[model samples]
Target: MQIVDHGRVSVGCHVANGWTVVEATGEMDIFTSPMIRAAIIKLLQDGHRHFVLDLCPTAFLDSMGLGMIVAITKRIQAHQGSLRIACADQRLLHIFSLGGLRKSYAFHDSVDEATREVPRHNGLGRWPRPRD
Candidate 1:
């Protein structure tokens, strides 16, 4: 796991053999959302469509952050990829659920579980199987 600091925000990236887990901390409003967006996009460009974003440490999130998530989800879907979030905070979970995004993205409790759910690199050529 490697942590990259972008001033107010910190992005912790855990790269496994096939998956990449990003743990974001600090505020994710209009100002810092782009950094998160870019980081995810870069991974996508690197042919990593399966992702797990751990937002447990995130203090706050605004519309822009939510929008970025939506956009990333769409991008992943477009490529027949998958994206999940590990967020245990009730407030953030409430916002995601109330916003109707709960049905769109899978939420997990830990990075280990998230990565386990994601398929291996060889399986990326095909769309993900439905979760049980």
Candidate 2:
């Protein structure tokens, strides 16, 4: 994993089970969210269609960070790809719920669990085997 430490935030990535797992650590706020976004965008440019964003190690997530995530998800879906979030922090989960994003993403307890259920999306933008 090539991890890039951008001050208070660091991002690393690796491929597992045909999905690119992007692990983000440290605070994700207005100043640090861009680093995370850039990393994911670079992967997308490199033809990575499936992704698992592992945010378990993240200590903080502000509105900017949440917006960045939503934007990334939209971009992935536009490419007929998918993005799943692996986050176990209850506080973060609650934030997601409060932001009305619980239905917008597949949140997992771990990266293993998230990668195990990669959605098999067809060219028509439909998942033949819906992931749990």
lDDT of each: 0.74, 0.83
C-alpha displacement of 39 in model 2, angstroms? 1.1
TM-score of each: 0.81, 0.89
What is candidate 2's CA lDDT for residue 6? 78
> For residues 1-132, could you state the per-residue lDDT of candidate 2 as single tens digits?
755687798999999998899999999999988888888888889898888999999999888999899888777877788788899999998888787777667788999998886566722154323334
Predicted structure with the largest TM-score when compared to the true one: 2
| Worst 10-residue lDDT window, candidate 1 | 122-131
**Pairs in steric clash, model 1:** none
Q: lDDT score, residue 17, model 2? A: 90
